[model samples]
Target: MDEAIIAKGLYKRYKRVQALRGVTFKVPRGRVFGLLGPNGAGKSTTIKILVGLIKPDKGEALIFGKRAGSTGAKSLLGYAPERFSIGNNWRLIDFLVYVGRLHGLSERLAAERALYLLEWAGLGGYEEEKFGNLSAGMKKRFGLVQALISDPEILILDEPTEHLDAIGRLEVLNRIRELASRGKTILLSTHVLAEADYVVDSFAIMNRGRIIYHGSRLDVQGVVRIVVDKPAEFEKALHRAGLEYSISGNEFIVETSGVEDEKLVLRICLDNNIRVIRYDTSSSISDIFMRIVGAEKR
Candidate 1:
């Protein structure tokens, strides 16, 4: 199947709070799909449904054509929740092996896989460390290691880098990129758009329990930035052409559809004797996120 996960018109209400409102999106196979939004945006709720932790009050979710939360679907997936609890007494290696066994691995194989993964995740010599003894960053990485024990085809990570320092966040993100390179489909949910900016192939922004925008990262509509030597003439020309734009010093940012619109801007500048010093398309992920969610709020 081309789509790895599909949420179809999902709706869920808890007491007086509506967690999901006809939420819908698809995660394509072998690609990183980011579910981004602020807190209370229902990102967690949608992730829960995908991982079979909770059943939606209405609509359905599918995992490779299998009903979400079904045995078949669960077997092919790995999950790392934003917050998880483990006994303080449990040893890191033992916990991972136990989880591997539950997934049907032989005892010996489970131990072997656990050790390999722990080392790969930078926890090599800490196999015997108690769960509560590890540092916060190590604990988070351990959670990720355990989820990967069964070598799942799909990974669902909820706020994987939350509360981590800059370095910790980078380490976790690099691991995610490596997994994607190995052809594993990932559904990463986070409030920080910058965390997923470099890795995500496509994304959906959620707010108020609904998706405000969904599109490929490359297709995100960012402003066209132009640097001109004749700032006054350029500004006047833009005003005459009735184009929506913003100016800061010598740079002019014009919102445009594509190359055609860029060409139009260029022609306008040329006609007005406005020397175009530089022209480019540049916008950060956070910029795109704010634009989309802000518009939804209005």
Candidate 2:
């Protein structure tokens, strides 16, 4: 696959605290890559380095084969920071237009693009409003508009849906999917794994400034939880069916090879005349995240 971004042995420090420790990852072109971790896991620091806001103390970050922060690389990148800020006094349209012009667009072209973006961001009617007066969701949308002013090839978003309501989160996530479908490479840095799972084709899980796991979403393992009326009979059924499972309280977490295995577990319970109270197939990204982090701590 063609790589759009590469970080190799990236290390950063602020006084005594190490923000990044030998961080490395490759983001393929035209894919939504998730940089996932809890707070202070170096997500923001890594993003800042990629966008040229700050330099790494060691190692390097590259964009499309060029050094990060180089003019060629910067021109292809757009960024929406975790904590977005804009001049409060500036009208929404004016702010977007100014940002567009700063990206080297002509005045007329900037105004045109700004208007188009305003409509796309659902802020067409709020153009005259001051940036400070806009709601949290509106500000996030405006930040996205500014990032897209130059039609960047890669969008690096930090906590894109941080404080939005349910509706607002859905809208932003849908927009991200649309961009990816249009062949835009996106690096979404977020702690919200459940939401990220919806759009990311691949992901890297970070912990305490180190990436502990990275893999395609399709390869993520699935577990099925089943609660039954007869625990002893269920265990016998599982062994007879040659299925691996573990019991916790009243629930059995069956290790499934795929959808067929999940179905087999249900069939086993039925064949043994066991009553199943709950059959849960949904697996959470948070569960995997916590398991990894918790194991590392021990």
Candidate 3:
């Protein structure tokens, strides 16, 4: 895949806090990449730099090979932050029309586009509703409509699923995947692991302003259950391998660095005739996130 966005050693600092330090990741064209982390991680800070909302203290960020925040770069991207950043007083359609105009659209065309967006977002019946009166999910759809009004090549989303319930989250996730299928590149920053799991093509897991892991979902192991007749021998092997292994009953908990490590252990066990009774790996996105962020307890 071609690179649509890239960041190298990005650093951002506040008066008393270093929100981002040496953060780096890449987004390939026509794919939805998950920018995942727990609260207080640098997901938001990294996105702000990508969308031109804020500048980085050090290092570099680019959109389509150009410096981030330049008009040429910004024109290629649209963003909807975690917060409802649009005007609350306007009706839903009005807000869409207003944003369309801001993007240099004519009044008549903007109106037509607004109606189309409303229907597309499942809000056609609520066109006259005030933005402030809409439910959180509705507001999110409204925000998404405006971001796409510009018909940008790239989309920057910060916690897009933040205020959504189960159905709402699924809708958003589905929309993101649809966009990716249509060749739109996306930077999806979300705490909702299940949403990311269902939609994202790749992920970068961050923690305390640093990226701890980044790769395809297939590479990470979220859960492991190992069964062996001589548990002590397997436990010793795990220790010698310098892996983070836990225990529950006679079952061993193993988290591989990636598929490569998992293959290594499996090969060794099979060769040694270790009577493995059971072994399983979890693909749960939530479990992956917790382990990556060091938030999992045993």
Q: Give candidate 1 regions above 4 Å deviation.
A: 230-251, 258-272, 277-280
Full ranking by lDDT:
1, 2, 3
Clashing pairs in 3: none
lDDT of each: 0.89, 0.88, 0.84
Colliding residue pairs in candidate 2: none
Against the true structure, candidate 3 reaches a TM-score of 0.84
Which candidate leads the pack in TM-score?
Answer: 1
TM-score of model 1 relative to the true fold? 0.91
Could you estimate the TM-score for every candidate? 0.91, 0.87, 0.84
How far off is residue 23 in model 3, in Å?
A: 1.5
Global CA lDDT computed for model 1? 0.89
- When 1 and 2 are scored with lDDT, the better candidate is 1
Error of 1 at 88 (Å): 1.4
Q: Could you arrange the candidates by TM-score from highest to lowest?
A: 1, 2, 3
Tens digits of per-residue lDDT for model 3 on 140-239? 9888888888788999889998878989988877888888889899889988787888888889988889988788777665456788887888888878
Number of the top candidate by lDDT?
Answer: 1
- Residue 72, candidate 2: C-alpha displacement in angstroms: 1.0
